[model samples]
Target: MAQYSGFKQLLIYAVSMFIIALSFYQWDMSQRKQEERIHETQELRKQPLRETCAGDKETFKHRLEDVRNNELANLIVDDKHGIIYCYIPKVACTNWKRVMFSLTKDEPYPDPASISPDLVHLPNILPFLNSFPRSEIKAKLKHYTKFLYVRDPFVRLFSAYRNKFQEHNEYFYQRYGRHILRLYANQPDPPQSLKEANASGMRVSFQNFIQYLLDPLTERNEPFDPHWRQMQRLCLPCLIKYDFVGHQETLQQDASQLLKILMLQDNIQFPPSYENMTTPAFLLDWFSAVPLEDRRKLYELYEQDFRMFGYKRPRELLDG
Candidate 1:
């Protein structure tokens, strides 16, 4: 009876071991399949961007030399990690700047939130790709992982208007606000100062801002401001190949994936993005004041950006 019991115990141990091994194999296969799915998703995003750049002959020069310095200035370079990020204004850039700041530090990087948002934007706090020599720039472009985040064109424009005009921003007021108010707001003699403007309740309306963009003279004189500039122009996606193309719509997922790709996922974290009040749903209401012809013209201006970044054309706004 004792001998029979010992044999039964051995058989049970063997069965348990087999089950454990099978579970490990199944888990590993699942992980691999998940990774494959991720790779396919990334390819879907990148392939179209490449095709768009290749197809557009007028806008895409396909050469870095044709790109000007101010344009390249948007690219923030991190030599230590070999990462280059092209930051667009109003696309969670403040938080992204903080992440870049943390990566620049030594091992056990500081929490991104701990860094001052304003300090990162201050000149010389972080190195820009444009600041490097021509040879260095070329080398970094070839070897480093390049990425940029984009947003819905119309939504970005509205956000820019709300932040610069509706808010009390002294510099924007002096630079673009005053001009927009004078020309579009029908305020020929708008307040000279932001404080004065706020006190008198004089601000540029959304329609006025759109009119400024559609105006022939706006581009004839100078390029659009960086805050309101098209993502294509700011990042030079055609000339510089970006490894990862993130959108504001999927900021967190894209950011997390990018950090993992860089092998910094373990060392750092992307800050939580605040809720964006401006969204596609709000586009119709905001554009209600804008004329149909002007809306079409605005779309035409940013058509390259929409196509390049894979954002669906705003048919709702344009159709009307």
Candidate 2:
């Protein structure tokens, strides 16, 4: 009877070991399938961009001449991974810039969160597509895994205004904010300095910023500040065939899929996003300051961006 008990214990141990091995094999298979699904989903995100670019030949006619220095300046390149990210301002670009900087380091990349925001934006920190010769630029554009993120044109505009004008951003306040105040705020004698402007409680309203955008002189004077420039103009979606087109609205999922597509899901993680991101719900209050005529005209200005990036026209604001 004692010998029979010892045999039973041995049998139980063997069964337990077999179950553990089987579970590990199943887990490994599940991980691989999940990775494949992520890659497939990432590819699906580019379909809309392809369809839009193919149909929009009229916009492409001038692409050759339009591919200027400024146009290529935002295309941050990661040669190690063969990735080119066309970053649009106010479109989670800060975090993307951090990621680009982290890629430039040696193996065992530091966390993107560890990089300073100011350092990432410094032009010297990252190599842009424009810095390369025309031949190399063309080669990289063709061979690299190019990607860009877009946002609702108006919402992005509002966010830019709120950040630059509403907040105490001295650089923007000096360059564009002052001009906006002087031109549209009916303040011919606007304050000369941000400190003075803030001290007196003089601020550029959302309506004033919209007026500046609609004004012909704005672009004629110079390209719209990248912060407020149309995503189409900045990224030139028609000029380049981006493998992935992410939207700011779905940033977390899109960023995740993109990392998986690049096979960096295990190596790096996207930085945590802010909770109070701009939303469509806030449009009504913001647009309350904007007149209907100006709103329609503004929509016309960015109509191409709306169509190309699959952003629905805000009928409520435009119609009303």
Candidate 3:
């Protein structure tokens, strides 16, 4: 806790480099979505293709791009105080960066990466939220607002599997070779359930996720790594330190309130503008893409997240 008691102070004083690392990562992300998975391996086939608007590739691509390019980047709301935005993967981070960089009132130097190390008191990239840890640091926020955003678990998990693990793409394929799911018509497993395929680790293969899932059992015998079973355990402990929790399911509304908390009420609105607003249909498709059995596992795994954030379990979303 840095002591500002406002969002602006947190942003202005945040470890800006994490945001830069995030931004830099996104620059490479644009191409990932459009590229074909023709060169995929066996494990890459564990998940199926996202449910588009009846195969509306052009529309889907364009809309996703719009969200990534402008909507996400433009959703910034100045808290007018030093703010710390602990970014969660694939949760509209780009827009947050654009917003943070635009703080004209008492903004830091033009370059954020340079100042981020000092602010966060870290010397390297965040690696994973686990190793660096957030719990031990919240007590220090007495001077600044400690904030982080969360998303609907179903939405977030589906987006991750549907999108080829966005930030973790290279790792997913490289580690799990034949175990991961791909879009290839000839894939061995072809987007099967995690229970069936036994996916876990974070390795470049689908097996990584399976191994990751099985890591808990491993701890009694071995330890888990590159696995959600392990990573979730690692990060769950850190989540306790977060003082501000915003939900991604209600981005526009949540972000608006966040800005107000930081004293930027007049400068922003609830539900920031998304130029190509996604229809409720897309939201439905997004949830429906995942297989029901796998979804139940995911839902159970993320039950804490769903329950903690007040997310209503849409029966359609669950059974879809």
Instruction: Report every candidate's CA lDDT.
Output: 0.87, 0.85, 0.43
Q: What is the TM-score of each predicted model, taking all chains together?
A: 0.93, 0.87, 0.44
- Candidate 2 vs 3: which has more lDDT: 2
Show where candidate 2 strays beyond 4 Å.
Answer: 1-44, 61-66
User: What tens digits encode model 3's per-residue C-alpha lDDT throughout 13-49?
Assistant: 6758778878888976853642332113111311111
Error of 2 at 37 (Å): 5.4
Worst ten in a row by lDDT for model 2: 57-66
Error of 3 at 193 (Å): 24
Candidate 2 global CA lDDT score = 0.85
lDDT-best of 1 and 3: 1
Among all windows of ten consecutive residues in candidate 3, which has the lowest summed lDDT? Answer: 41-50
Cα lDDT tens digits, model 1, 1-320, are: 99999999999999999999999999999878876876787788778679998787786768878777777989999998899999999888998999999988898999999898889999999999999988899999999999888888878888888888888689999999889888888898998899998888777888899899999999999988998988888888878888888888888988888887888889999999877767667779889888999999999999988887778898889997
After aligning candidate 2 to the native by TM-score, how far in Å is the CA of 65 from where it should be?
7.6
Off by over 4 Å in 3: 1-82, 97-138, 165-171, 176-178, 181-243, 264-292, 317-320
Q: What would the per-residue lDDT of candidate 2 be over residues 183-264, giving only the tens digit for each residue?
A: 8887888888899998999998888888888889888988888888888888887788888888888889889888988999
